[model samples]
Target: MNYFNYKRRLSSETRIGDIPLGGTNPIRIQSMTNTNTNDTEASAEQVIRIVEAGADYVRLTAQGVREAENLRNIKEVVRSKGYKTPLIADIHFNPRAAEAAARIVEKVRINPGNFVDRVKTFENFEYTDEEYALEIEKIRAKLIPLLNICKEHKTAIRIGVNHGSLSDRIMSRYGDTPEGMVESCMEFLRICVEEGFSDIVISMKTSNTVVMSQAVRLLVQCMDKEGLSFPLHLGVTEAGDGEDGRIKSAVGIGSLLADGLGDTIRVSLSEDPEYEIPVARKLVAYIKERENHPEIVAEAYAGYSPFDTSRRETYAVENIGGENQPTVISDRSNGNFELNSHFLPDYIYVGKELPLAAPRAIPSIIDVEGWKNGKNTYPLFTSVNYKEIKGNAATIKFLRLSYAELTEEVLSLLKEDTTIVVILTTSHVNGVGEQRAFIHTLMNNNCKTPVVFNRGYKENETEDLQIKAAADFGTLFLDGFGNGIMLQNEGSIALKSIDAYMFGILQASRVRTSKTEYISCPSCGRTLFDLQTTVALVKEATSHLKHLKIGVMGCIVNGPGEMADADYGYVGAEKGKISLYKKKNLIEKNIPSGEAVQRLVQLIKDNGDWVEPDNN
Candidate 1:
């Protein structure tokens, strides 16, 4: 069987400084400097460090004309140090700054949400089609000068779109959706085309993984229709630090990369910028690894549309799907461990047939041949033998079907048992896509049986297991193909680690939110205080606030825009002060850093978002 081949998306190659993006170039890695742009020495030093850490391109926030003008000194300093890595001026709401940076840096990125319009002014007005055209004309008129400057300086431009920051004009028409995100970019893209500027890249970013993924796909589809093949820059904006952040970034960015969609990628973690490069590299390396796998030829029909959210219709099997949150399945199916509530799985597949007592009340799935007359467990039947087993009084049963063994008989057998939940597996190359195709077949045939996505890996190395399993399972979860996830390795990884990864993937995909989310940015020279230490302190103080999102920013430049999704924000306001926000509303400013955490707790408590840590 031939495997699914990832043919890179065709895009116009654009050069940034000495670096090239799109076309046949290897997918590039990018990171932004958190430093103040006016601090030329600090900014240049951070850029060199980012380059040393393997960033192909570095971006600096240019909020005003001074920072934009300072790019000259920053560029000179880095060049004097012999670092030719492309420096991009990140501009928002200021066309003049973009103009200045265009002449100074290799590339300039402007947000379409605010380049010409006053953002977050909360203006609401219904624009007629003519009014909309006039708005575009205004934006085009404002953009032409910067476009000309970029063209003259041979600078590339990235028209990045954020889901949270869509202009009121776009919101009135498109309602803050993936369609709106694409249109936001299209508005600018059309101007670039009209101005005869082809050196362009684009991004559709959001903290929400699903929206980010959907928006990017829609952008590609829409751009394709307009005959535009600009390169894509992919990232999950303001993804928080730690494993949760990593998993979320991987799922969103990796899913698209697997489909061969991204040209340059940045893993936006609330950690040091250098820390992001390694994660991005790991994801990019998976593309090469996929190419080396054995090819499996199969009809591609993932039951769900990758471009749109169409969750498969599944009948409720107790607590698995139909209304319940997606369940997590862990296996002691191959090893011996004491099952306790701390590491409890919703369901378990028994590894050995020994009737050993467990530490808690948990359901188990017993193999057909190993089944007893009155065992208090569900039976697991393979595709070939599932039809032979007599239906039991048990309300639920397990029917395991491998894609390699699926056939007309299996499909027919699957349809006959509404009580049987299908456990879908694939031992083929491109397993994720294969499993997706299997689900697609089931849905096409109108089979509504809930699916449990199951995969086993031979690698016991924890990091490798986590990344590979995440790439395989994350894409499926994002596409809405599974009701539950069951993962196994050669028994090398800890049960608790696997458990964490399972929930982490589910949480990161936004299918479930199980913990407090932090949106921290990588510290840069622009940061007024110690970001790494500050984030650590914030997490330590607020980690127990489950499902609450907190943004810890080093400075205000990109902080406000990046942390748009955070429920509350703790941002550095000045050299020794912090600002607090209640969902983008500034509530306190210039609070001494010494008292910020304690004061934040009080604020959370006042807003009824605080909960005492569990002590039981």
Candidate 2:
């Protein structure tokens, strides 16, 4: 795939029931049921709801052969009710269940991490070359049966790899990195090809958006080198509920989709499965608009690496770059600047006039004409006026320039000025690519001035703005391209909403964190308690802890391993019990579900990681 061009990665078409995916097919949206698979009535009903909500496919967890067999009953019920949407059986650590489901459902998803290899113990062990070859043979021996089953039944297969659930064998070789994740899937894909089974889909998921995006991109690169092209299934596993989940999903999944990678997508949320479809649909619709986007003419930067998260090196101009966290610049150019919320922006761009009562601590950006030599105020000059103000510029100045404006002369001038921070903007339809091109130019020219992305949105809904901005800005941040972000909306959305989302984009990108990050999984049949309700209780109790990451998983299937980056974990242990974890290590086992939240809180306190919520 061309990094600066808009072209979907073409893959062989794979038929899943009546809906075909990849190749020339439209991107498909899917969701999974949280109801117990054995409770066929509830599971079937949820699947119908998801289908009605615009899901092209629905999946249910098949932990054992019993649940796998029950999938046939669920499919029968849905078929009887007139919903012909393709059904996918989600299998983890159970080849028998995958074999059973492959014969019953339209598709079967098996995690390559544990389908054959043992569950991850995170224990490091050495693997000799011959030993590793033996392990691959083991995988081939186990996976061939499932591939034959799939081919015989005409059922598609998804070799899903999760970052948190990488096998001990893979970790021993690749150390739980993107390379390991890609190799995990490739090992299975190669086996499928050897078996002449071509009906397959692929996914690389993680709660960490950075790792998730990187792994998927790396997977594509590896696949291209070997000439394999299976349809991609995109998602950010364990993305928590509400706006955060939406933003995080968009950041991870949208980044890949923007690169023309995903063939099918699911917006995983800690809510009813049906609710995820609309968000997934909205995300797909947002990216689809770029399919025919105007051409972006640029060469890939020689210094840029697409597969890693290395911030583009730049000197700090004030606190906007270098070692500082990525700053947020609120566009209050309409003059409604009021620092009313806890989520404060590091800078405010007020266009021409600084708000009379604007706080002095938060720097303000003004048009070059209105910029006075005052404390905490900076001038924003366009390419045309930058030279004129260069001599009399403030100690810290903002230069607004598009990719086309970064001429040789401007590059030379920027290299000489240590005080200027470039505010990068783009009018092109492929704004992310254009802005990225601008950064690459600066990097190649050896300019150390910090560049802040300035994107303007008009007449868009709040959710649309969130998804779009996160995709655009989050993509750059993930690629290590920006030092700050300026989100400008001329729509009717509140400034506070925009402020919150700006921080959200930063947090989702893993560049900055201004609030508590939750890595809660979308509940499935294996979930032990009321996941939705439990997440709410956990959030309400722990939301004040801004510097922490908490994982609320419904069951052990998505337990410690899935929430690998989380500082604390609340995993379901039994029907009415919960397991609390300090990182990946078990803290307390099987606490009653009713007391899990308080117990988790007490666990945080016990570890001295808790702080009293400020009532002020």
Please state every model's RMSD to the true fold in angstroms. 2.8, 1.4
lDDT of 1 by residue, 375-413 (tens): 447678886677755556566778888777778887886
Runs of candidate 2 exceeding 4 Å displacement? none
Instruction: Compose the digit string of candidate 2's lDDT tens values, residues 1-616.
Output: 6777778999999989999999999999999999989998998889999999999999999999999999989999999989999999999989999999999999999998889877678788999999999999999888999888888899999989988889988898888698889989999999899889998999999988888888988888888888988899999999989999999999999899889999999999999989999888888887788777787777677877888688888999879889889989998877776664669998888888777867778888889888888888888889889786558758888889998898888888899988888899988888887887777777777778898998988845877898889988898899888889898888898897899999999999999999999999998889889888988998999999999999999888758898778999999988899999998899899899988899999999999999999888
Positional deviation of residue 160's Cα in model 1 after best superposition, in angstroms: 1.2
Against the hidden reference, what TM-scores do the models get?
A: 0.92, 0.98
Model 1: which ten-residue window has the lowest total lDDT? 1-10
lDDT of model 1, residue 425: 83
| Number of backbone collisions per candidate | 16, 0
Cα lDDT, all candidates: 0.81, 0.89
Candidate 1: RMSD to truth:
2.8
TM-score of predicted structure 2? 0.98
